[model samples]
Target: MGILNVTPDSFSDGGRYTDVDAAIEHGMDLYRAGADIVDIGGESTRPGAARVDAATEVSRVVPVISGLAAAGVPMSIDTTRAAVASAALAAGASVINDVSGGLADPAMAGVARDAGCPWILMHWRGHSRDMAQLAVYRDVVAEVCTELLARVENATAGGVDPGQIILDPGLGFAKTAEHNWALSRRLDVLVDLGFPVLFGASLKTYLGRLLAGPDGTPRPVDRRADATLATSVLAVAAGAWGVRVHDVAATVDALAVWRATGSPRLAKP
Candidate 1:
């Protein structure tokens, strides 16, 4: 999956493609580069960010969804609001990638159930504004797994078919650097939950911190593509069903090489 964030405050690549034309061109480019799906997000989920109104959120992504859909590229809307998800799907989004995992809105699960589209439910504690306060965990991996499973149950009970659902651990949503690392190290646990797992760790600050630049300062999120690619391939090796990313071309190329060669798709160290 290729990530296309239209919000001006996303931690990475914000303001780079807020225009509909530019965003659509970028989505098409991702399709050409080897992304199986392009995910469009109108809100910035960077920690402590303020929420955008549903109207503005819809405005940011509907046209992109429409253009991508018309171009025959699969598209997913990265939103937590039921209103935005419904609008985007009506406008031609095929998947609902909700980072909140049905916690923010009681109507989201029903919406997905009615639409019958593939729903990507991520493990989240609260909205971006207050999620950090909810990140405390006794066992980050086990707790995340359990919470995600509960979300799957909620979606199922709400009428979303078990087969049409996917799970995401939400690498940077509210996790500390160590928590993210632990989740990345044990992605196989998520895969064992009987649903497709989506890993969305592209260009996150955690990777930047891990792979500091030569100046001894943490690398910027925009400069973490190589590290992101490494994590993508590792996620695949750990049995992740898909990887969400900003630079789809690089990920696709790396995956192609792994698939073409006799090596494992994820080639974990």
Candidate 2:
């Protein structure tokens, strides 16, 4: 999967694709560069980012989604609003990647159920504005697993088909670097839950912080591609069903190497 953030403040690559034409071009570029799916998000979900009204978000993403869909690019609607999801689906989006996990909008599950498309329920404690404070957890992996399971149950009860549900551990949302690492190490736990796990660790802040300078300043987003590729290949080795990424070509190459090797381990013991 490739990420297409059509918002003005999405931590990285925000204003880069806000224009409808530009967003469509980028989505096409991602597809040409070997992306299986392009995740187009209208609102910025960065920490402390303010929310956009549903109408505004819908306007921002619909034209781009429509254009991409017209061009035969598979797309996923990255949103928390049911209205926006519905509009995007109408515009030809095939999947709904809800960061809120049906917690923010009660109408989301209904939209997914009605569409019968895949709904990605990311493990989220709250919205971006207050999610940092909600990162607290006694056992991060266990708590995330429990919460995601609850989301699955709730979504099913709300009419979404069990087979259409995809789980995302939500690497950066409401999670500290340590929490992200813990979840990465225990992805097996999530994989064993009988749901497809979507890993979205591409060019995120945690990778930047982990590859910081000697003075402890985090690396810039452009410099995080290498780290993203590492995480992408490792996630595949660890049994992730798919990885949402920004640099699809590099990851595709890495996965090619991983497949050619026929051994997941890059180093011999």
Candidate 3:
């Protein structure tokens, strides 16, 4: 999956694709670079970011999705609102990537069910504005897995087809750098939960912090693409079903190398 943030305040690549034409061109670039799917998000979910009204979100993503879909590029609607997902689907989006994991809106599950498209349920504790406060976790891995399972259960009960559901660990949503690393290392726990797992660590704050300078300034977002590729390769090697990334071509090349190495099985800890 390739990420296309069409908002003005996403942590990375914000304001770069807010224009419909630019967003569509970027989607085409991702598709031509080997992305299996291009995920277009309108609202910025970065911590403390103000919410974008549902109407604005729909307006931002639908045209781009429509353009991409018309060009034969597979697309996913990255949103929390059922209304936005419904609109995007009508515009030819075939998947719903909800970072809220059905917790934010009561109608999201119904949208997924009626659309009969894949739904990505990311592990989330709260809205981005206050999610950092909810990051408290004793055993991050075990807790995340358990919570994700509960989400899956609720989604299925809400009428979403079990086979159409996918799970994402939601790397930077509400997690600290430590928690993100811990979850990344133990992703097998989530993958073992009988659903496809999506790892989305592309250009996240944690990677920037990890690559911080001696003076402690975080690495810039553009500089994090190489680290993102490393995580993508590792995640795929560890059995992730997919990875959402900004640098699609780099990730594609990295995965190709890993596959050329016979796709060696990652060792158990």
- Model 2: how large is the Cα RMSD against the reference? 1.9
**TM-score leaderboard ranking:** 3, 2, 1
Task: Give the per-residue Cα lDDT of candidate 1 at 32.
Answer: 94
What are the Cα lDDT values of the candidates? 0.90, 0.92, 0.93
Task: Give per-residue CA lDDT, model 1, range 65-173, as digits (tens).
Answer: 9988999989999999999999999999989999999888889998899999999999999888887778788999899999999998888989889999999999887
Model 2 clashing residue pairs (backbone):
none
Candidate 3: C-alpha lDDT: 0.93
The sequence of per-residue lDDT tens digits that candidate 3 reaches over residues 135-190 is 99999999998999899899999998999999999998789999999988988888
> Judged by lDDT relative to the true structure, which candidate is superior, 1 or 2?
2
TM-score, candidate number 1: 0.95
Sort every candidate by lDDT, greatest first. 3, 2, 1
Where is the poorest 10-residue window by lDDT in model 3? 260-269
Alpha-carbon runs more than 4 Å astray in model 2: 264-269
